[model samples]
Target: MSSLFKEVDYLRIPYADIKAATNNFDIVNMIGIYHSKNVNYYVYEGELFRSGKRINIIVERILGIQEVQLLEGVSVISRFKHNNIPTFVGFCYDKYLGGYLVSECEFMESLEQILNITPNPSIRKSEYRIRENLTCYHMLQICLGVARALSHIHDCHAIHGSFNSYKIFLDKDFEAKVVGLFENPEYFPLTRYTCYVDPESECLNIFLTPKSDVYSFGVVLIDVFCQQHAADQSWHYLEFPEIPEIEYTHFDDNIRKQMNSKARPFC
Candidate 1:
């Protein structure tokens, strides 16, 4: 484990510290859960003490993986220092419980949670109500922030292998923080969010590229504008073959009504 993170400058926290911060992985602290093959990662919101100062954090406990398998992803995360990306706080590994990757708890809630469109039945409903009255302007800002984050990642010569709305979180001011980067795209499970997977990658067995991330982002755009999961509309292509384009009518009625003539042209 030491050799795996020797070059990485992030913290190497003790497993006991992580356990104490998260109250022994209590159910009340669990905010999210992500599945990759047989591995189940549980995300918990907690506070850690470092240098006599309290630091709020989000800890993702990775189950069913060896320490060596975590190096690539952890290294990639430590190099990112963009505003739209969550700050990598540190990581902890236990011989019995697998690994834990920690990040500063700067986000209020994930976009999936706030939009109430998560496919995961295990995710707890968001308790934060930062945006009770979401506006079209707010939605545009969220999209723009995510776009900038993607551009930054591409400039760094890395891809967010599994880019989707569920990986996007929001702050109290609606700023976007994209997480879950550097996933092995080829190994990413197709059972969940098959709608967001790029057709080229899914059908042709092609490796995920920057273009694949763009395709997923397009689906995320649809989710934001329609106020629904893109999977809900995945059957349209087969059901209405003649309608080759997504018409203006496809947008959520409330969001469509909010868009003026200028915005209509862009949509």
Candidate 2:
């Protein structure tokens, strides 16, 4: 641990160490840039980012930023105190790499990945699957989690500025922790562009506030219920317009009405 980090209460980490640990951006360790979230992504050292004696680090490449932006974002993320969001640990700079946002790396899969592979495919045929009391449980949990994250930031007078599946993750216990929004400039900015952002695709033009998060959350809900996936092989709900709403109001109702009822069960 660096003495600088130890001296501070949040986290103690050095930018050089994270680069070295991830093999200096080696392709072998490269997890693939999740371009969906506006920033270029390479899941280094696996989704779990554990350092020597400290917590793990979620390394990402946020295209545009300086120390000022990093600190500004840290000030906001650090104020978030909720189980649904990862604790804001600290931030760092790397001349070799871009500025880095370090947080208490949580172990979990994203809700997008969780619903991507549904055991029951037939359910997607209906619009009502979204409000289904049973299946929507996952959606409901995600909604609550997102609400909490948004509320937390709003309480601190900060805006998420980027809201999407790529910016959110599901912990081992299935808790949603919003991440990578303001942290990565180049990537996550575009992540919000899918919806929360205005048509122009600019940061100031984007609306990542709580209401915007709600809008993104609604899109996520529909995707999870419909089992829609994009041809690009990214987020399960990347195909937003085609399947934003379930075919019916109730899961049982959709079961009987889905025009594609003849399609294979969601396996």
**Best model number under TM-score:** 1
lDDT of 2 by residue, 1-267 (tens): 344334443553576666675567566543224544334443443232454355654555555445445555665566677887776655566554556655565454445445443233321222222233233345556667777877776676666665655566665555677776443232233333244333334434553345555555665555555554312233334545321222343233443343344632421
lDDT, residue 163, candidate 2: 60
Q: Over the stretch 1-267, how does candidate 1's per-residue lDDT look in tens digits?
A: 676568653568888899999899888777766554336667777889987899988887878766665666777678889998888888877668888888886545668766766555555655555334567888999999999999888777777876777678787888998877354444333322246667766665666777878988998998888777766444433532221233343766656666977567433
Model 1 poorest ten-residue lDDT run: 240-249
Going through the candidates in the order shown, the clash numbers are 0, 18
Q: What's model 2's TM-score?
A: 0.61
The alpha-carbon deviation from the true structure for residue 167 of candidate 2, after best TM-score superposition, in angstroms, is 1.0
lDDT of each: 0.72, 0.50
Off by over 4 Å in 1: 1-3, 36-38, 94-96, 119-132, 183-193, 232-249, 261-267
RMSD of each: 5.4, 9.3
